[model samples]
Target chain A: MDRFERQHILSGFGIESQQKLQNAKVLCIGAGGLGCPILLYLAAAGVGKIGIMDGDVISLSNLNRQVLFGENDLGKPKASVAADYLRNKYSDLEIVEIPEFITTANALEIMSDFDLIIDGTDNFSTRYLVNDGCFLLKKPLVFGAIYEHEGQILVFNSAKAGGTNYRDLYPNPPAATEIPNCNETGVLGVLPGMIGVMMATEVIKVLTGYAESLENKILFFNSLNYQTYTIDFNSNPELKKLIPDTFEAFRAKDYSLSCETIPSVDWDFALSQQNSDSIIVDIREASEMPKLEREEVLYLPMSKLLKESKSLLAAGEVYLFCQSGIRSLKAVTELQKVLPGKSIYSIKGGIAAFLSKQEESNTYGN
Target chain B: METKEQKISVRAFGMIAEKIGSAQIQLIGISTIDELRESLFDQFPDLKNMKFSIAINKQLASGNAPIPADSEIALLPPFSGG
Candidate 1:
């Protein structure tokens, strides 16, 4: 019996389907966390040709979940490390590396060559980029995300075989601040380890044409309870309408080219205005992260601001904020509906950039 | 049926902690902090955490934990996302 046949029978995804996996080409975006496991499983499963794209270097922080790297690999670009790691692990597999960030400028060019795409990005901007790019190209996207203990996965644009895309679930992109990254909160090392593995499973199934792919559905996993549930999705006309009739439009209306567009404030000007007369209102939720420090700051999670704001601030100048500065804008919009003349502006980049501006203090206790 | 502010304690983490100083916050609330916070989240729905855990009077509680005015509450961020 071959190593592939661990089961009693000759069943292993079989030989013909195996050949399809051996011949298929796949592209994986991001080479950290989820990307590492995703690439590892795919190569070992014998994906004939695989393109790994990333511009990020391995950080000391990445070692926790990106098991593919070692202490000596820190600071090296992830794409470089992952490519070499995959090749060494499976010398027979065709492992290729596009040593650059996937951006709107090159989404189509980079994705057009692959049979499938696995989005391992940690932020919404990148997820949106991958969603739009894959939709435009009509390629399959193997998407995964880990937030604390939970993870979500979706297979979009499945080989022109009538699969749904990202927009099927979220019809429109919410402001970026609404979703903070692991950096702002944090991820348990084991969390991504599990989610990323499941993602690789989906990819292998799609590659071998074995088992079933999660098409037009979003799968949710609760690592705590170890339960898996899925929500059905429809091909929303809102998204199908996104399919540009020509590659020119796909390239012209570029997305995914930028790794992240952080919302930033006019810090120099805003900080100057932080005085006794003005109150800087942090509109982020209690747990929504990247907490900044300042004296003039008023800690009112957006929830509180909307409720008793009138009583709390009978008369005052209020500036709103959240993680990315996006939510602050929304809060400002909402506040205007009630207190028409109240002054409110979102802190640019919310607290992320705020802390980035301030000298690095001790990282918050985990 | 309802009274004014009662003295209580609260806990927080992640960016929330980074914003508010680290310490068991001794404060006042009418009911429970969860109730207070949920009303906040209603206006700002994005903060809904699948893993938003809480502790009431030093014991972990669900989203529905009832607060009897000024009861201590802790807003915890997800622990597994590390």
Candidate 2:
């Protein structure tokens, strides 16, 4: 018996549609709650090539809804774990694992390989990045996001001509702390799974033409009362101008929550550039530990650094780092106002990212 | 002709509904998206900082378009959860 025998026997979704599922390539971003089911069904339906891109690791809390992994898979990279699950189930399935988060530098190159992109990420920055990247590449995108008991799904860039993108729906991102995510608000465990299945259905519809796709329409679903609303929208010409004009400009654009744009570098770049021309400053408070013991690394905390920003005028370039990348990015935004002419860069993942990378390398090297 | 303040039936969803303390409500004399926003903010001051889109009769409004009398309005905020 054929593997897709059930789908092949269907009247509308015959072998032709089954083959479309086998021949099409799809890339899914974020292997959390939504990504779990999206990946499972896509692979089970015989999607030829699947790409899983996520930078998060599985924690104990995620076992409730991220159904792909078990307790044994804790502390494992989501992309690799999900890819491995699909590969083991379907031997012929082609799976590509990207163990890094999507960024401006890598968005275009990573998205160019697939026919469709599914965004299940939990942040506004990555959602906008994927939306803009799909528009730039002219690829169909299935976007799904959730909050508590409600979820929203939209199929963008698949309308054959001019259609709505995410920006058309929300021209501007919400302020950093204005809107809360599931982390703060808390979500029902089954909410994302239900929404994720709908997102996957949309992907199948778009690829195989089994049904009318959700193009130009955004569906809002509330599982509590089983209420659903489908709203029609069109691409705004004025909003299209907000996207970068070219690939180079897109790469240079800042997708962070803050309006202030700052260049960010990895730990390696910050470490290598510790010279007389460029100085490295630890922006974390004096109480923070696991501190860098290098003589060249300065220990000026962010609180006092703002007041005495001019004290480091002699250095041609300034590199800032903190416990995590959040504070460092904010510090760069503040310091830029004080020292307008100086070059300031925030270390991408701060000390935590560097420590994790070192641990991974050690595990692999052994 | 006598002037009557027509009411618009507004339905809020997700965070917007949570902030307003109800999923459904009625607003009087709201003829445009901006006016509806101002009235909502006047009532629920917490909504001033929240981000949401206004849709009239199930169609997303890109600008401050005029709202017809007795239109079915909805307030939708972007959901960031996966």
Candidate 3:
């Protein structure tokens, strides 16, 4: 009795389907909540080659949903940690650990190697990046995203022709400020597990030719209500024009600029500029947690900061940060307009980046 | 021409539900996707700034497609989480 013997014995799935699973190469982006279950089932079902790509490290907050890592593995890179655990569990699994996020510069080069790509990332920038990259490469992309108790799953650009991609559903990302406060509004732990398994089911169907995969369709599921809706979508030629048609155009496009106008600096730069002459304004709302206790940092929500941009003219350098950096960039764009010659920078990845750095330093004693 | 009142049932999902304050709503005098959009924006002004798509009778609705009488319409906003 082998690990996939049960699946192999199913009516339509046999040794042939098992062979297909074993021969397939899939790249799963983001080893977070959804990535954990997607990777588990895909490996358990005998996927011969899998690529785990995530630039984030394990944190205490992630333990509840990221099932692959425990407290003992805290502060370790997600891609490497997930790869090591899967390798230990399965002897023949070929795992590629990409301990980095996929950017326009690397998306095409990295994604071109896989038969399919699964997007389990949490942010819109990466979501659009993965979808556009797969569209350019002509690879099947299994898309899954969660919001509180609800999750959305879809298979885009499959081997089947005339299917719609993510862009068709929402041609442009919602405004940065309009996006829900995800960091503050938490997700139900089991939501991703349910949706991830569904996404994995699509991957298997798409790869093995077992059944009808979710090509040209989008699924919406709410765990609280246990209600599911599968809607059919068609390619929008106008929306298709919004995506880059050629690889060069794809690489040249600034995907992040859709949310961020100015390129942000890392913790080092943000820290270096934190002096009496500079102001470190926290742009998160008053209720948001892990509030910075530093004396140099000022607490000003985005709403107040944008309205009060003129008052910051006296500050030497303005460094803004929000929970995850999106709002701060919006703030910088607004501030730059008011203070043309002034240096207003956004701390990339915001307080999350700062805290992750603290976690890394605490773990390594650097 | 005799005037007939058009009432369409709308189902909101994801963020749209939170914004609209209900999972489902009865929109009156809306006979097309464009009309439904105008009515929703008129009723919930915040929705005008928000991004969402409509699905009429389970098919993705685009370009002022007619809302069939008694059609089940869905308001879906893109979910960015995972």
Candidate 4:
């Protein structure tokens, strides 16, 4: 009776699968909710080498979902803490602690050594970076994400033939403002456990060739009702246009930039611009609600601005805004192409934040 | 002759589900992914500002594809949170 006796005696698993697991090298990014379970399972299963890459320190808030840490583990770097915990429990497991954020400068070097890459990150920029890097490095990517009560799991770049990548599903990154991570939306404590276990299962399936790979399909699970659905995806030719052709282009690309939101000026700064030579351009469509009544505001939709950007060349300083700051960020990106060195800013939170502040000020004044 | 309207069941996931206020909904008179998106945006304006993808009959679909009547549709947003 050995450590792997339970899994070894299972119907489809045996010493062969155990050996494969022992020889596999896996890297999990973002040692948070999903990472906790993934690292636990992979290390416990005797993965030859495991890498935990994360730059975040454990906080009290992570306890609900990130099960790897206890109260004493707080304030420690996630990668180091996760590595230390697993190393202590399983001395046979070799864990590499990468206690830094994955950026273009180091993503390729860090990820290239692993045979499989697990994406447990929380931000779109890192998600896209991991996806592209895995594609370039040709490593299998086990992807998992959670929001509120729901979770998504997918395996990308696994099969040699007819496999769909993340870009196939999301041709472009969503506006930063559009993405609401767990920090904002919050997550149920057990949701990541469910999804992370599934991700680990997929990793084993991929490594041992035991089950069919979730290469071209995505699984969506809802904990509220415990309902699960699988969605199939095709490799779109058009999506290739969105991916960079060369490593140089991929490295130079800015994943953080999105048309939906950009650097925005505060309400006070926008107010100051009212008396200055600065121009405020509203980029919302005509049908959109909550119009600003300021006399200095220019009512120009994004469609019109795209066609007639030359109209803005004469302005010394320009401010762009939309209903929720997403379109204005996009407008800033678009306008910068033509306006070059001209001063342009996207009003943060757009009219939504601005109007909320206005109502608050009125209530306080009374 | 007036064509019969198509009705599809839509499942919204992640933040898009929060914005729609329901995990499931019955969408009427929608024949294409593009049309369904327009209807969703019309009903939930905030959805237009968020990033999400549409899956018809459990298959990821481009906006121009024709969706079968009574097909399963899902609005999926990116979930990067671990």
List residue ranges in candidate 2 displaced over 4 A: A259-366, B1-4
Model 2 chain A worst lDDT window (10 residues): A176-185
Q: Which stretches of candidate 1 lie over 4 Å from their true place?
A: A1-12, A159-163, A242-245, A254-366, B1-82
Clashing pairs in 3: A146-B81
User: Which 10-residue span in candidate 3 chain A carries the lowest summed lDDT?
Assistant: A254-263
Q: Stretches of candidate 3 above 4 Å error?
A: A161-163, A257-276, A281-317, A322-324, A327-345, A349-366, B1-4
Which candidate has the top score in DockQ? 2
lDDT of 4 at A198: 92
lDDT of 4 by residue, A216-236 (tens): 889998898999989988777
Q: Point out the higher-scoring one by DockQ: 1 or 2.
A: 2
- Candidates 2 and 3 compared by DockQ, better number: 2
Write the residue-wise lDDT of candidate 2 on A119-231 in tens digits: 99987877888888888888899999998889999999985425579999898787654645444456777999999999999999999988887888889999999999988
10 residues in a row with least lDDT, candidate 4 chain A: A254-263
Total clashes in model 3, counting residue pairs 3 or more apart in sequence or in different chains: 1
The full ranking of all candidates by TM-score, starting with the best, is 3, 2, 4, 1
lDDT of each: 0.65, 0.85, 0.85, 0.82
lDDT of 2 at B19: 87
